[model samples]
Target: MAKSNKKTKKADEDMSKKKAEESKVKVEAEISNDTADTEENSAKTSEVSVESLKSEIDQLNDKFLRLNAEYQNYRKRVEKEKNDIFKYGSEKLFVEMLPIMDNFERALSASEQENIESKVLDGIKMIKKSLDELFDRNGVKKIEAMGMPFDPIKHHAVMTVESEDENNDHVIEVFQDGYALNDKVIRPSMVKVSH
Candidate 1:
């Protein structure tokens, strides 16, 4: 009976140890599950933050593109305005000088036709030469239209004459001398064309 009792006590102790081990394994599994859940939640929050940051970056990139386009358009508009200013800046001054040029031309024609004194004619010629020099210095140029092809851009045809020659479409006479400023025609030459 005493040996049986000792054997029974040993069996009870073994059963308790097995139960303790099983409880420990269960607790460890619960802890692992808790850690996995926390890690998963953290990863999801990080992904959300990354996505938000990417959205912000895209907004900034779009704004930058719009601003860049606006700046380019502004620059082009300013450049065109600058070019227009340069192209027509001297037009007023040129128009003011036309009367003086016409008077000089009339005087030259009168002097040649009326047999004016040599000294007076020479003086008038000197003045005319000085005017030519001034015009040349100011980017002004004279357009030659006599005996050349008639062009509406440089020559304004006043009358047309009938001719049988191959070059009949050319300018035969220039009634008014044309002037240009920097390759832009300020006035077209009044001409007569043979057709």
Candidate 2:
């Protein structure tokens, strides 16, 4: 009976040892699985963050390019306006002098009709010639109105005249001469349009 009891105790000890080893193996397997899951999650999170950062960078780059292009256009527009201001700076002064030029022409015409002295007329002609040269040098040009098609841009019709000889909507006579500085019209010609 004593020998049988020893054998049974040894078998029970062996079975307990086997159970402890299986428990240890199961715990180790669970720890390894948790570590793998943590690693995979971290990798996925890092990839997502990287993708989000890339998108943000792309958006910022696009905005910068747009702002740069807009600034360049604004600079070009300002430069053009500055050049125009310098080119047409004396526009107002030239416009004011137009009436004086017209009066000089009228005075000469009246003097000629009155049979003014030849020496006096010659002096007047010299003054008129100098004025014309000055205006020419400043890029001032007279707008042709009479015997031309009526242009609303260069001519202002003060009266409509009935005419069978001239074409319809044609300028018959100019009451006042128009002048231009470069491509800009300083004043439109006052004229009679034939219908």
Candidate 3:
């Protein structure tokens, strides 16, 4: 009976040990599964964060490019305006000189028609030549209207004339000469267009 009791006690201890080991294995497996799930969640969160960061970077980059282009365009526009200011700076002074040139032309024509004294005519011619040279140096140019097509930009048609020799819309006669400074017309020619 004593021997049988000892064997029974030993068997009970062995069974308890086996059950504790199985319970420990189950707990360990549950802990490992939880760790794996946590790692997966962390990876997914990291991916989302990376994607969001990339999207933000792209938006900022696009905004920067647009602003840079706008700045470049503004700079170019300012440069062009500065250049134009320099080019047309003396336009007002040149415009004021047109009437004086017209007076000189009238004087020369009257002198020629009246058969003025040679010395007086020579003096007038010299003054006119000096004025012409001054105008040439200052980028002043005459708008040729005689025998050309009537251009509203450079010519102001005061009257229409019937002509057999000239084509329609052609300048038959120029009543007043036109002048331009640096390709910009300051005064338009008064002309008669052929009908």
User: Largest lDDT belongs to which candidate?
Assistant: 2
CA deviation > 4 Å runs, candidate 3: 1-31, 118-123
> How high is each candidate's TM-score?
0.65, 0.81, 0.77
In model 2, where do residues sit more than 4 Å from their true spots? 1-27
lDDT of 1 by residue, 1-195 (tens): 999988888888889889999999999999999889989988999999999999999999999999999999999999998986787688678867866887888899988799787887788889889988988887788898988988889999889999778897799988888888878888889999999
Query: Candidate 3: which pairs clash?
Result: none
- Local distance difference test scores for all models: 0.88, 0.92, 0.89
lDDT of 1 at 24: 94
Candidate 1 at residue 8, lDDT?
85
Per-residue lDDT of candidate 2, residues 1-195 (tens digit): 889989898889888899999999999999999999989999999999999999999999999999999999999999999988888888989888988899889989999899887887888888889989999998899999999999999999999989898499999999999998887889999999999
Model 3, span 30-95: residue lDDT tens: 999999999999999999999999999999999999999999999999999898777777778878
| RMSD of every prediction | 5.6, 3.3, 3.7
Sort the candidates on lDDT, descending order: 2, 3, 1
Using lDDT as the measure, name the better of candidate 1 and candidate 3.
3
